[model samples]
Structure formats: C-alpha cells, structure tokens
Target chain A: MTVQDSLLAPDLPFPIFQISQTVRRYLLYDINTVTWLRRTHNILGVFIGSLPQSPQQNVFFGLPMELQPEEATLLVEKGLAFIADDFRTHKQAVRSPPRAMANYKATARKEALATAKAVTKQKQLKTQEVLQRLNVRQGTPDADNTVDNDEPDESIFDTSTQETSSRPVSSSVIPYSSTPTTSYPPIPTPSKQSSLPLPEVSASSYALFKHLHALGYFMSPGLRFGCQFSVYPGDPLRFHSHFLAMGHDWDEEIDILDLIGGGRLGTGVKKGWLIGGAVKNSDDNEKHVATSEDGQSEIGRKPGDFHVRTFCVEWSGM
Target chain B: MGDLQPSALTAYIEASRPVGVLPQDSHHHALAAQVLHNLQYQHDWTDLRIHTDSSHSARPLLKPLVSGLPPHRIYVHPDEQIEMLKQSVQEKDVPSEREWVLPTHLRETWSLRKFAELFDGIDPVPPAENQASEEKPPFPTAKGGIGSRRGGKRLMLATVGDDSTVVYYVVHDGIVKPRQN
Candidate 1:
C-alpha cells in the first residue's frame, strides 16, 4: 500500500503533530490518519492516551499514538507525513470567526433539542405501556378504560407527567458537543517561523531504522527492552517483537560486556539482539556536503544516504 | 575463603540500615544506598545523602530517595534552554542544582500513579546542600549562582540492573516542552 491508497485524502500528507519538544513527544490524534498509517504503512506507534472505560489501568490504552523520532523522521522522508507544531496550530484554530462559532452552537442546540424531545416521547410511551400492563395484571376487562379512568393510580402517571413537563425544552443541558465541532477552521499551514522540521534522530540510528523499516518490520521505542528499537515481524498487536536492536557508529568501539548483556537479555525473552551501523564510504563526504547544504531547510534526509550493516546475536546457552 | 573480607559496600549498607522499618523495606534502603554509593564513587557525585522521610511533612517516603549534586547538570528544561539562548548563556555556565534521585531495581514495574505520589512527597528541587549528613563537606556554591527560575519538579530515575549497572533518566512531574536537538 502506498500514499495514494491511504484512507485519508490523497493530496494531504498525514500530519504528525509535535505535542511536546522537551521530551520529544510526536502524537497523531486523528483516528483516520492513525488507521491509514497502521494498515497501509505498518507503522504502529504506541497509543499513550488514557482508556476512557478503565482510566486507572495502564494495561490497555486509547488514542493519540506516540511515534518515536525515527518513525516520525521516516514518515516525513517517505512523503507520507509532515511534522506540525501543535501549539501554533491550536492557537490559530481557537481564533476562528465568531460567525462560525455561532453557527456551530445553533446546530448543536438544534440537535440536542431534538434528542430531548425524542427521549420524552419515548418515556411517555413506556409509561403508557406499563400502565396498560398493570391493568391487565389486575384482571381488568378493559385495560384502556382503566387507564382513562381518573380514579386509577395517579402516582405513576403524576411522576411521568412531571418528568416530561420538567424536561428542558432548550438544549442547555448539553454544555459541549460530543462530536468534534466543525466550527473551528482547518489547521492552517504553519508559518515558516512556527513550522517544525522533522524530529532529529542520530544518523546511525536513523540509518538502522530505515534499513529495518524497508524490510517491512514494525519497530517501537526500545526503552523497555533496553535497546534502541524492538522490531516485530508484524503489527505489535498480533506478534511479539523478534529482536532488540541497537545502533552504533560504524567505527565506534563495542564493549564486549554490553554485547553479552544485550544477547543474554534478548535470549531470556526469546528474541535476537541485533546491532548495526551505517558503513562509511566515499559517498559519506558527499552526504555530509548534502546535509550541510540542506541544513535547516530540508525536513528529511534523502533515501539511500547510508549503507547499513547489521549483525544478530543469540546466546548459545553454553 | 576464611581470609575473605566483607566489601566496603556491604559494610556501609549494614552500618546505614534505616531504623523502625519492616524487614522487606530494608531491601529498598539497601538499593538506595547502593545507588548513592555508585553516584559518589563511580560517578564522582558530591554531597550525597539518603532521604528516608519526606522533605515536606517528615512522613516516611514511599521509598528512600538519594539526593546529590552531579558533576554536570543532568537536565535542562526546554523553557530554561530558550531563556539561556535568549541571554546568549552557554549551558555549561549554568550552575548544577542538587537533584532528587529515585532508586529502583531493574525488575520492578512502575506506574504513573506511583511516580506521581513520589513526586508529591518531594519538593520541586532537592535542598541546595545535604543538611542531614554532617561529616560530608558542604557543596561549594557555583560562582554565578543557581538560577532563580527553577523549572517544575523533576527527579533522576536510577534503575539498577543486577550487574551493578545503573541507568539514569530525568523525569519531570508533568508534560514539559521538548528540547531542541
């Protein structure tokens, strides 16, 4: 699946909003965009939203998928998404015209009033049915006559009548719309001054991420697994991660103990410990030049910028 | 085997055992002390002290916390960074503040509520000096002085693996602005 086949409009790149800069939180709140990214691109960013049903429990989560920096960078590079500064867009959205706000309020009020009326009618019908049933149980020959009789049980009818009468005719009960209101203008393209470039990731780590991503593996932040990335063969929902991947500079010294610890940990969890880096080559100088030229102007790196080499380690249990 | 001696860490842990706590709680005290030991010797931290009670109410803390001044500032709040950038002040020039360190075992599972409770028990910033420990010399105040506008409450989470490897992460009380790379 490609960008053209996305559920979202073909022309619009999925917007990955930078929710926070200090802790580097990139979030996607739009359900459609999240679904498209998951189904089409196999990008299963972690859902960090609190589940409404069980707000206290952390076993399950809801919405606002949090993407790792590598995932965000990859999506931007592939032209599948763009980073937007959420604070700026939100400020712009709140400044919508008063006319639009009034129009939305009117529509919302109308809908609420209709719902209130329907609920009252339904309640009245239920009361009538119950009254008729009570009369039948009392062996009344004419249930309808019993209901119409003024001497019949007035308590139930009185309460029902009072409830219907007390029901608010206006839609003041609803303080806000349950659905997202269309009154706010669409998020505008951020001005250059406020625009956010793609999230920055280490060159070697990004290279490793790009390499693994191209192989159709789904990856997530590996803080829990004590590695740079935990890679799964399919959606995390359906499969366990198969590897704990760490990225290092090509010429950087490898600590033997770190390799052993990673391997042992991975083996304990039935996964491979993988290490990799971008191999330095003559094209590296050109890449540096390209990076310098694009500095602060480009949102993502060009494809095929780095040649990555990877090794997977599994403990022999000797 | 007969000539073997107890290591300094073991001896220190024995000597510093917290009083009037459950036997299991001693394990946590040991963990905090171990982290403190690592920070002082391995990491060259100064004015290290183990906190058994809340700084605010004097109630016993959920777990012992270690307070120390690191050789360098472990975190720079995004807003603080922006302020420094505007003032053209280099980050290194900023005085390092004493930090709260929550020590945990690598095997333990943590939740947001637990973290929030921990944050509530502590102050926004650790006390400037270790007032509880008298033997240790007071940390010398930096020449420029610590900034007045200290950011929100934060702590350094130190997870100690079985192999004696301690990994530290800076955790703030709530969502903070992201720092530039």
Candidate 2:
C-alpha cells in the first residue's frame, strides 16, 4: 500500500518523529509510511528504507527499499509520500512477528529444541559408556543419569548464541531460538513492528536532491536505469524521464562495472546518467556542521555547507 | 498489521513457508515475491500469478515472471490511442489494464539474447485469471520479435535493487512509435 493508506491505520503504536532534514522551506521529518502517509496527508515525499516483503523474504533476502531524496521533498509539497524509517535498519528491533514470522520462529525454535535435546542425550549416553570402560562407579546410579537425560542442558543454547548472534532472543525462556542452521535473525517473540522513527536521507543524496530540487527537476527513483534518481522535465506521465541521476560522497570510488552498466543502460534508453557529490567548502569546513543546527527543522541538510557538483554521463560510441 | 511494517506482501510472505508451495531459487522467489507484493499493494494490481518453470521450451526462465491486472492503465495501445485522437479526447491515456511483469535482479546482467528468451516466452497480455492457475505464468499470445518497443512489445520489467526497492520500467521488445504526449 502507498504511504497514504498506512496513515489511515488506527492501531499504529506511537511513532516518535525524528528530525531527518530540511530543504528550502520544507521540514523533512522522518516518519514510517504509516504516519508519513496519514499524518503528512500524502503531501509528497519519497517513502524510503523498506519495501513490502514477507517475513519469508526477510528471512531470506532482507533487502530494503530506499527513498530517493528528490521524491521525499517532492512528496511533502503534494502530501502523497512520506520518508519512512528504513525498515531494514529498524528490523534489528523486530518486536512483533505477526502470524507468519511467529510461526517460523515457533517451528524453527521447536526444531532447534528437539534437535538440541536429542544431541545432548547422545552426548550423555556416550559419556556413560566411557565411565563403564574405565570401570568407574556412579554414586547417583542410573536414576541420576535418567534425570539428567530428562532435562536437556540449557547451556547448549548459550554456546549457540556465540555462533549466531543475529537472533533477537527476548530471553532464554524460549528454547532453541539460536538455531545455527536457521538463517533468520531471531524474530523478537512479539510480531509488532518497530515504533522507532529515523532519518531517511543520506547526506550526499540529500545534497544532490536539494541541488536538483533547486534546479527545478522532477526526480523519482531511478533503479530502473540503475541510477539513484530519474530526473523528469515535467510530471512523469506527461514526459519521459530525462536523466538517470546518482549522488555520491566526494572521496568514494565508484566501481568500473557500475560506470559501464550505467552508461549502457542510459544509452539504450536514450537518457543521460548523471553523477554528483557534495564538495565540502574548504574555506569553512569546521563551521558547516555547527551551522546545520540552525533550528528544530533540519538535522540533515549539511550539503548547504558544501558546494554540490554534478555532470551527465553520455555513452560515446567511438 | 502493515501499519508499522512495510507492505502487505511482506506480511503475506512472512505468514509462512508452506511446504512445496513457494518456487525454488531463494533469490528468484524473493524477486517474484517483491513484485507480487508491489503489484498487490503499491499499484492496486490484482489477479497475480508466478511462473518458475517454462512450458514453451526446455530451459526454465532465468527467474520467475509475473502477470497481473493493473488497477490503472499501464500502456496505451497504439491503435487505441489513434482512435482516441480521432475523437479528440483531452485525456488520451487509457489503461492497458492487463500485462506481464518480468521480475529481474539488478546485480545480474542482461544481454540482448537473454532479453530475447524472456520476450519469446511471454505474451502480449497477462494470463487469463482461470488458466493462470492451470499453468505457470508467461503465456505468450502472439510472437513479439524483440528489438525495443519496435514491434509493439509489452513487458514491465520489475527490477529489484539490493535495497529491496523494486522499480518498474516499461520495456518493449523493439522500437515503437513515440506515444503522443
């Protein structure tokens, strides 16, 4: 569902609105789609940080969708989209399992527990046999051995924790949560989504987004052309996208494959692949961060302190 | 339940790993599942179906492809647009309504031949609701020789980025006339 549909939901737990950024006159607060959609009134903003995938997908491919910065700013004025916390990042705090995720954990935990008990029992038997070979006497007799067999050593689970730390085990009360074979991070026992708010835009992308927004280009997600944003001269339906734009940090090195692949995709589709970055204003580098704290509105927008530079990549068929 | 979570499809996938129900190739299933989720929720798409194995040829699709009925018009058929133009309707856009979703991963590379195989296996429209269950998706109606949008080809390539963002672009087999803006 779009962010607008989510805000209509009445049962959302309290979501703390974190200040993410500010561009021009707009206040870019970070809210998940639910709040961003409903609270923000679908006014426009790129809903970033998580795509709707199943718990099964989370357990397997946990890739989350990021919001294009231009879309984020674009949505605020229109009240259609919202900058949601990256679901992938907050999933580290997966509190609620819903039905499916709970089921996976229930089954996986049971499987792990059963396996844990069986393996421990075998170790007990082997240890007992070793005593027999050495002619050792048991003070507690078979009764003690049977009792030990009845209770699986909980310590085995502690060792399992060392091997797989991603599991969000609420407590040791639930057994077999640390299943080594199970690739899923321990589903926090409850199925509730995280209530924490977050900042959606990265520094460099936000800078580029602000730069492009100032230049008056309609920007949307450009994953279609393997770029960060797709620049449009007008509303997307009215015109084909003009450029596949991407933003990077000043010192970051881009891979050659990205250059070739991006160039090819752009040329094939007849669009330019635009790359850009925020170059720190060397004259006043230290004061830039200090100046970003202008007000309660922007905690992001550090790009203002640096000059933004960009260029279009067109494939030259020599 | 999706209030604080991501999309409804996410809830659906997390619901269970029904034994023998989901397709193999964890990544393929992941890509298809993402597209299916986006269709069902993001764009109000319905009647979704998935195809992992191919019936037309010996080779299965590199990944599963999807087909569904879009809530809004996706593409404007050229002939239909011409008819609309003749009537002089201000809004020439009409939903193509039904189409196929070609699920792809960004990390993977695509050559012309690979795209040809995909086009060769697909149809002008999505599978019918009834027959959809009887067979896997990707029922090619008429032969669409691949080029650009050249031969009136239609396939929405749903490419999934590592970040879980699935951006869809209308990919035609060959270069077709530029639609009247």
Candidate 3:
C-alpha cells in the first residue's frame, strides 16, 4: 500500500475498547497509540481522565481518550481499528494467576518507598541549608559544622519529625495497601472471535462525519459548543475549530429559527455553522434495510452508497 | 387555550413565597418558580415543590431547586436498565423516582465549580413527601431497592431561554456509565 492508502487502512489496526455498552463509550488508553492515531489517521479523541498533577482542578484533563461513535465506526469500516468489549477482557484478567497481582503490588510498593525516601532527603537538605544560613548571620560559621554533625540519623526515618515539618508529606508519597483504581495490568490481545461489531451511529451523522473527515477536517464532540461536532482544519492542539456541524436526514424538516440561532452563535465565536446530510431516495433506504435483514453488518456496506451534501452558514453584518 | 399570560405567571411566582432567599438572589427564586409552574402545568409533573435550603447542610442553596415527579421517568441509568431487563420487568412497571431540577437562565455561564457546589448540596434522591399516601413505592422491593447506588446523584439542569423555552439536560454528580443510543 502507498503512504496515502496506509493512512486510510493500516496493516495492523489499533484496538478501540468498548468500556460501556449503554452509552457506547469507546476509549483508547495507550498514549503511544493515541499519538499514532492522530498522526497517521487524523483521529483526535477527547481526553476525559483526571490529571494526576492537579486532580482537584478541572481545567486540564488526561487519558483515556474518548472517541465519538462516528469516529469508532469510521475507523472500523476503514479496516484501521477494531472494537473489543473491555468489560469481558477485565473479567478474564480477574481470573488470571494471583501471583501476577502480587508482583504488581510489590513493584508499586517499591516505587512508592523510593519516592518517599527521595522526598525526605530533599527536605532534610533544605533544612540543613536554612540552619547554616542562620549560623552565618550570627557570625558563628563554626556552629554550622557542629549543627551538621548533630543531625540525627534516626530523624531521616522518624515519622514524628516528618509530621512536625512545616511542609506535610503529600498523600501521593505515602504507599497504601490498596491498588490505584486507574492502573491496570497488561492483558493478552483479544482474539478476533471476541471482537465486537462496530458501534451503530445515525446514518446521516456518520455520513456527515465521513465527508468532513475525507476533506481533511478533524472533528471533536461539540456538546460544550451546543452542536453535534466541532470541525477543525488541522489538529485541535494547533488550531481552533472552524465550524460547529449539525447533521440531519435529507427529508428532515429544517427549523429556520434553529438555523438562525446556530448561525448567530457560531459567528459570535468566529466559527461557521455547518449542516449536512446524506441524500438517500426511497429505493436506497429499502435496500439498506434489506441488506441489514440479510445479516450483513454495516461495515459490509459501501461508503459510496449515498452522497452527502453540506452547507455552511455564517451571520452577516447586514 | 391562549398563550400563558405574564400577569398569571407573576401572580403564581408571588404566591409561591419562597422563603430564606436573599434579597439580591430573589430573581433566582422567581426563575425556579417559573420552572415549577412549567413542570406542574405544561409537563403534568406532580408533587412539585421548590427548595431554597440545602437538603444536606440546611444552609441556603446557591439557588432554588425544583423537585417533582414527572408523568414518566425522565432517565433510567444504563446499569439499572440492564438489571430491569434481566428481571423481565416491563418499562411501565418500573416506578418513577422524584427528580431534582436546577433552574437557570440560558444566558448564564456555568463552570465546573458551580456544578460541583450544586451537586454537593443535594442528596442522591430527593426526599419523599409525608402527605402523599397514594404514591407508589419509588422502586420495586425485589431488587433490594437500588435507590441511588446504581445511578449517582443527578439533577435536571433546566435552562430557560428568552423565548420561554426550557431545555433540560441530565447533570450527574460524577461519571455515570453512558446509556446506549
């Protein structure tokens, strides 16, 4: 395959795990794979995980990245990704050897101990420097050497001293017996037989997403913007979204007031309001239903089965 | 009937007489009253009441919240739905729970802190009324009364636009499993 073909359909497809069935949440947890998806396939999922650096603050988030159903469906259709039921995989992991779990705990405890020791050493050094400065100010620099010699070795491991320090140790530094909720042990790749069928999205919305994606626009969920999807000309990290897109069926009624509201809102934010849908006649609709009834998955259907038409609306000063 | 008269809405708001609301924040009570009126009349919700004090802290809430029973259940947690399906429970057979409604203007800007504060003030389920003897149990007893464990604390965020159109979105206290489309 040429480079362009590889971009559309990679030889080794990535796995998108279906964590929840009801809400149809597809998440990709591996950061390296997330970067690869963006660079190679132009797929940009939202990071919905809390940041470890500042878990209390909501301004910045971390992984696992959440993919729109349309994005997951498109990736599966293109032979670039597959969906697996993570809950099933998790159940399987629970049945694995207890020795593996013990090993994981041991490693975590060792890491935590090292971190705590490092923090204590750093604090002790800071305290020694402060004492030396005070000795110099008193014109008794010799006392600094005595103070250093008098430093108690037991104080390094003393819990009371650490607790009485001006800066209390953060909870993150203390090792707890319970495993962290966020971390998971590595599991074997799920077999093809265990892979789930791609998620089902509204036909019109999928068509609109595929059309915009084909034209090189990256999209993200537009719930924050009060729209279906936010369209970006380049990677969202490097560029602002250019449009707030809404999809409809070809014969669906268009509310003029809703259109005006969308246009005005989009213009106020320097974005255009985009509306689009797949044009399907009655015959095509019947054929689609017939094919589904014949036990053919949506992936077996062709993208060229319908043509999508899109229009961009912006408020005019006049 | 004709469009609801502004004078009637004003009279209803006055009659509600929401207490413990600060003078400057009286507009919030009016907003909650407007939503309560809509829920009771337009939506056919029953057992409607406006709350000015926090159920947990007993302190005045950031704003008034309207609690009522809708004609039908507005939301069913995905996990709860699966459990009900396994038990072969009919959709109509599942008793409806009272919903907490947070009323606000569409033009208002909301932040995560504001939402967090609101969620902190309320209980997972709104308190049941003492006078309603005819009301059915909130949940079937066979399921061990899964009250709020499966579906965390949530509220109906009612944002009223300038056109008097109230749009509601389910706002949960924390991450809840997504429901299938």
Candidate 4:
C-alpha cells in the first residue's frame, strides 16, 4: 500500500491486498488487521454490556492474549475509540457559555442577604435561650454573682437587641464572618487602661475626645489629651472628621458656605464641639499647650511658644 | 454573596501579643492602641484617641477628629431630609448639613445607658473652635475658621475589626426623622 493508504489505515503489519482477496479479511500481516480486530472487540464489549470499566483497564477482548509491545498500542487505541464520542460531547458542554451565570449571581446576593438575616435571627434566638438559661441558673443558690468574663454582660448587650435588630432589613447583607462580638478584646479596667487624660477632663474636653473618637481618629491616651488622628503626614486634616464635616456643610448645607457655611458658631443650642486636647506647652508654667505648624504639639517649644485649640457650637436657623 | 464589600475602610489583624504587667488586666487597651495607630496611618484620620469607660462597665471608645471632613451621613432620618429640603429653598444661605458623623469605632458591646452616659458627656455641637486660631498669637483670640454654622447632623461611625476591616454605620442619640433609602 502507498503511504497515503497506510496513513489512513490503522498501523499493523500485514498484507492488505492479499487480505481483501481472502475470506477472513485478515492476512498474515496487513495494515487493516488492527481495525478488523478492534471492530471485533467492540462488538464483544457491547454484547457483554460492560464496557471496560476504566480507560486504563480497558482491554479489547478479542486481541491476542500475548501481543508484542507494538501490537499493544493497537489494542489501546481501539479501546480509546469506544469512548471518544462521549468525551467529545462532554468537552463541548464544558466549553459552552453558562446560561445562568448572571442569574446565579443575583440569586447569590439574595441568598447572602437571607443568610445574614438568618444569622441575625438565629443569634437573637440563641441569646434569648441563653438569657433564659441564665435566669434559671441565677435563681439557683449556686449562681450568685457568677459573672463570667468569657461572655459579654448580657444585661448590657441584650437590652439593645430591639434597637439594633430594628434597623431596616436590607436584603442579602451578610455580616462579614470576621466581625463578631467575640472578636472584641476584653475591655480593660479604667484606671489601668491608659495614661491618657481622665474623664475628669472638662465636659468639653471629653466631648471633643468622643467626637474625634467617633470619627475614627486615635490619640495618645497617656499624654495630655491632644487632637491627633491618623492621616497622611504634612496634611493631617486630610481625612479628619472636621474635614468631612466641612465637606458635608459645603456640599449639602451651605449656600455661601465659603468657610463651612459662614454661619456663626454657638448660634444653635447644645453644641458638641471638640475643645482643646492633649499637648505640651512651651513654658513650664504655660497653662495652655501651643500647637506646631502641623497642628501638633510644637516640636520644640520655647518659653513663648503658643498652642492651637478648636471649639464648636450647634447653630440653627439659616 | 454578591462578593461586593460595601465597607470603605480596611484593617489588619495583628497577632495577639502577651500583655505583660499592666494593672487591671488591661491588655485590650494596648491592642486598641495598636488599632488606633493603624487607623491613623491607613485611614488618614487626625487626632485619634481611645477612651475607655470610666465606670468599667462600658466599652472603650475610638474617637476621631472629624470637624470638616465629608463622609457618610452619620445621622439621618428619611423624614428629616425632606423637611430640610423643603426648608432649603427659603433659607437665606445654602441648606444645613443633616448628619454629624463621628469617625469612631467600637470593639465591645454597649448598653444604651452607657451610650446615653456618653451622649450626656458630649455636646449637641462639637467643642468650640480654638484649634482654628493661630499657632503663636500673642493673645488667645479666635482666628482662622470658627463659628461656622451647620445643623446637629449625623455621625459616621467607623467600627474596626481585628482582621483590619472597618464596618461603617450611622448613629444618632435620640429619635430623628427617618430618611429615604
């Protein structure tokens, strides 16, 4: 046979011309012998109703029991053909675009929100159960003053459940798993916590601290209380709450808000201004600490160095 | 989950360290201090401080100095926004800002009574504008920008997690008109 005919035919060593002329369609050595053998085996496999259980284990039943290595390749190739159609179909299915991906995402968001809600509900139920359990335990003589440090004070946390859960039910808002009541480190005692100024700091001082605290700024608790929050250096006020407040005024409230609504401070009643904070004064006797160029404690205060202080008031009526 | 993280702030959880010899088992204060440092560097906040409860029955406070920043409407009632908008047209100047958000964080569970205690300590408006004055003025006269008028607005609360993620929320002391979604 020519190379073209041999390429098209299964690799085998036999006489093709003589085989066609003969009855079994097989010659002592012919290129089409493997094809004929595979067709035979395929028939037997289908007949047995159990295709070779695995690709690796597949053995054409009619192949010579003991074939040379070269002949072994032919038998394996034949077995591969039996399953090629199924493999091709699977591949095409995998490559095709998913029909429901978008729908899946939408459903996922809904599911997440549902899960979050469920978690909240479950937590509430668990809390109620624990509370009841506590009440019963407390009634027992052994339960007196058994304040467990491991658990949150349910009285404080439990009372707010109605208010906290009452928040509008937004769909699919899963609370990040990392956030939990457990994650909060146990709070420290007041006197040992920080060297920071005491609550004894005037109402205005404490108020400023609370306002800044709420705004995500942190300061040195040990030192004289100072207004210091995290921000890019050189421009400390870049993300300061004051900056946000000003923007809110300019964007939403002020008409001629050239400087945060040219409205006068203290025009409104009950202000929550952030008065002076912790800092070092220049003079040993300097009652008020002066500010540096960056609004921090002066780098090196001379006897004459001054301090910076911020004050605010709530104003109403245009 | 839609996989969209709505939180604007990010955080890192430092491995818990041994609390050496601080009195009153105050290791959490040190952790909070570390968190405060991270917030200042990462979130661009100024004048951040941690205030623990004096009564020991309350949680520690993470306070930020946000006087002029623009963030979420810390406090809002959908109903209040409409009233403010209606009044906006007749106002002499621009309308007043609605919420006064504080850039703060919470790590412990809080009671409303404790919250009220905190609220009681705080003024409806922020402190007076002394920081707005000059650094070395011969006299303690008010300078720069002070007395700027605005409403008793909402406060943006940035609650930090140990894993370095900050979940933000809006909070108000008393009842205010509700806002639209």
Expressed between 0 and 1, the share of native interface contacts present in candidate 4 is 0.00
Q: Tell me the tens digit of each residue's lDDT in model 4 across A193-272.
A: 21111112233334333334322343222111122221111123242223111112101221211211221221121122
lDDT-based ranking: 3, 1, 2, 4
lDDT by residue (B58-176, candidate 3, tens digit) is 56677788998887767766667777788777767766678888887876754433554566678877876665733576564554343334455677767678977776655554323
Worst 10-residue lDDT window for candidate 3 chain A reads: A287-296
Q: Which sections of candidate 3 miss by over 4 Å?
A: A1-11, A51-56, A120-185, A282-304, B1-181
> What's each prediction's TM-score?
0.54, 0.32, 0.49, 0.23
TM-score, cand. 4 vs. native: 0.23
Please state how well chain A of candidate 2 matches the true chain A, as a TM-score. 0.38
Please tell me what DockQ candidate 3 reaches: 0.01
Model 1 chain B lowest lDDT segment of ten: B172-181
Identify the superior model by lDDT, candidate 2 or candidate 3: 3
**Model 1 segments more than 4 A misplaced:** A1-10, A52-54, A139-152, A157-194, A281-304, B1-181
- What docking grade does candidate 1 earn? incorrect
Per-prediction DockQ, in order? Answer: 0.01, 0.01, 0.01, 0.01
lDDT of 1 by residue, A92-151 (tens): 766767677677668776776677667766766776677667766664666666546534
Candidate 1 clashing pairs, residues 3+ apart or interchain: A21-B178, A21-B179, A22-B177, A22-B178, A22-B179
lDDT of 3 by residue, A200-294 (tens): 89987898898778767899999988899999878998988878888877767565455557766876787767777775554534433454322
Task: Return the DockQ of model 4.
Answer: 0.01
